[model samples]
Target: MRNRKTGFILVEALIVVACLVALMAMLAANQHSSMRETQDRLRQKRAESAARSAVAYVFSTLTSATPNSVTLNDNWAQLGGNGNQSFELGDLTFRVQIIDANSRLNVNVATAPQLQSLLVDQTMVDSLLDWRETSTTPRANGAKDEYYTGLETPYIAKLASLTTLEELLLIKGWTAQKLFTVQTDVIQSAITQTDTNNRQLPLIDYLTVDGGAPNTRANGSTKINLGVRGVTLNQIVQLGLTQAQATQVFNRIPFNSFQQLLGVPGLTPIAQQRLLDAVTFTAGNRVTGKINLNTAPSWVLQTIPNVTLDIANTIVTQQSTGFTGLSQLATLNGVSPTTLPRIADSFVVGSDTWIVRAYGKSGEIGTAIEATVVLTNGKLQIQKWDRLNTIGIPAWWNWEEEPTSTTAVGTGQ
Candidate 1:
């Protein structure tokens, strides 16, 4: 048989070897793919488990409170100082900060200047003011048909009503970066509907006090200033109006209803709404407060003074584990006293909900996954959970930390 044709031809042997190699490669690749999927699934399961525990912890702590001791609407001062409680999971750590949104400017009710300060963009501030001023009733200046047609089409002449904070994106010069830089809550929406044409603009847009350019001096122009300041409110009672008059006007505004001051005398249409936007009257002096450990954006977190992006991110990543109280922040390598103080007022621990967010490992991927949680009645709940790597997030509740320990070594006994 000619020695069995020398077993096989070189070409045939080569082909068989190629086939074996191909099969090995396929098997190796399949194994790797399966392992990667399994690892991801495990990571997700672990993260979800941590989140549930965090919620349970939040509810247990708050619900166990004595009656009248901790009400749903209790303010910062009422909550007292932060404790040492913290939540940790895997490589994650979390803390809580309850803030009274009323104390801060409500973008919906804030004025142009207040918005400007919050945004820190002169052009954006000026443009918004110009639009509001020029767009009077039907035929406004800044954004009339003629003005809008000049820009890139399909041009939206004017926003009928700003239902969400993201609407600012339509306006010229406003970018996602610029809007988010100031920590504006894109999840929040505002509707400024003054039934009558001449009706006073809602004070919701004037959340920040009239500051910088349009500020009111002791002896200046005739413009009635609308600013919400501790000093201004105090002066309103002591100087502008009598104790009785101020009381009457003040009484008109109850919990979360400071916008009524738009009708107060001595206020221009702009000033009235500005003040209204700035003022938020809660039932008590203090109100519920919170900081989304996960969702607190960079700018807001950076406002914590020396907090670096890395530190903020670390805190965010650790959020699922849970946070007991405020001090755990010091555990971060870079966080120091200076940063803490600057950021302390900007954040609160132990009230309400939170969202933890992080970028994907690959820079090309955007908006990896953002976890949202709601803490009510002391329990933390996941209101919305999403992976924003694909479609953008929509506005919706509609409405809508950690540490270590030390012990004593020496004993007196």
Candidate 2:
């Protein structure tokens, strides 16, 4: 009887000990998970703060630059190109990149063939154009009011210009990857890739809604408005026109369009380009998707109708100084009488819109914000801000390769 009692007691004690061990294990796991989550939250807060600072820091370089000569070589573009430039803020790191809206093909102004350059087929182009049309009739290959309305989760066609580039996804057969993916591979070239690099970049990289602006000089000086004879004859002569040519050209306006000057006799190509730069006959404050000849990527220049690679390269080599943006291109080696007018409409000299992408990171946690910014009348304003949840990294930090550089950049940073 004594042995039986002792054996029972030992068994009960063993069972209790096993139960305590299991309970302790569960508690430890819960504590570990809680710690991890708290760490993640702290990282996130740091990232958010850094990302916002990056946007302000990067754009400060731009507002200080000369308006007419803003180009790919500018500090903002250099910092943003190829990869994100990094700056350290306290314990966190921030990255900033910039894209000129005027550098890309503006769907609002691009012709059908111009659209074709970015796409593989006419289906998306035709459907996109049809969607933009106010007319009820759809192109044969495109979806319109009827097709969109018939979907299971139906919505009507947008029937106008896209207010955002993301609107492309709403069109028939569009997908996220087709619009936003950026491919990575080894490549080398002297000219830092802007628009024309050979990479198979996503359409989103080459498309923007902010690609238009008021027709004025970069310094906010109004282009010499020629409508109703507002410009003086001497102003015309100063644009490189002969006295006879200036008088004839001056008398011809109240011109309907800038194209009218091309028809005037004895105005050389230099005068033609200078005249285009300094005047506008049309009534609107805006034009879209015209090339900023001073800054466009060589590939973008080639995309302009009748702009050959040689011509694009020639334009790429010359520097445009002062207020005459496109005038510098008129007398380039490849620009002849045959090529000038054909490609004339493709040129605009400066940009008012810049797209800023900034991300700040704390360890692996990150926050990104994309903003559309406009510079007008000597003031800078944010037109829109889109929190980019999945815009991805500018470039993976090679911390092991350059441990010192992984440190803070710049004195203030």
lDDT of each: 0.39, 0.69
In model 2, which runs have C-alpha deviations exceeding 4 angstroms?
A: 80-84, 182-198, 218-220, 227-240, 250-258, 284-287, 319-323, 391-413
The TM-score values for the models, in the order shown, are: 0.40, 0.85
Candidate 1 per-residue lDDT over residues 217-285, each given as its tens digit: 112222222223233346445434556556555544332222244345544333332332233333222
lDDT of 1: 0.39
Give the per-residue lDDT digits (tens) of candidate 2, residues 1-413. 99999999999999999999999999999999999999999988889888888778766776765445467666667663333346788888877667778777777767777666656556777888887888888877778989998999899999888888788888986667656654232123111224333444455655666666567765556777777667788888876778998998987888755456677888877678777677766566666667677666676676677777798787777633322455565777877776676677677767778888777889888887778887765677889987766534532211111222333656742
* TM-score (C-alpha) between model 1 and the true structure: 0.40
Clashing residue pair totals per candidate (backbone < 3 A): 47, 0
Instruction: Give the poorly placed runs of model 1, Cα more than 4 Å off.
Output: 1-11, 62-86, 89-99, 120-123, 126-171, 181-413
- Candidate 1 residue 144 C-alpha distance from true site, Å: 7.5
Clash pairs, model 2 backbone:
none
Q: So what's the TM-score on candidate 2?
A: 0.85
lDDT score of residue 199 within candidate 2 = 42
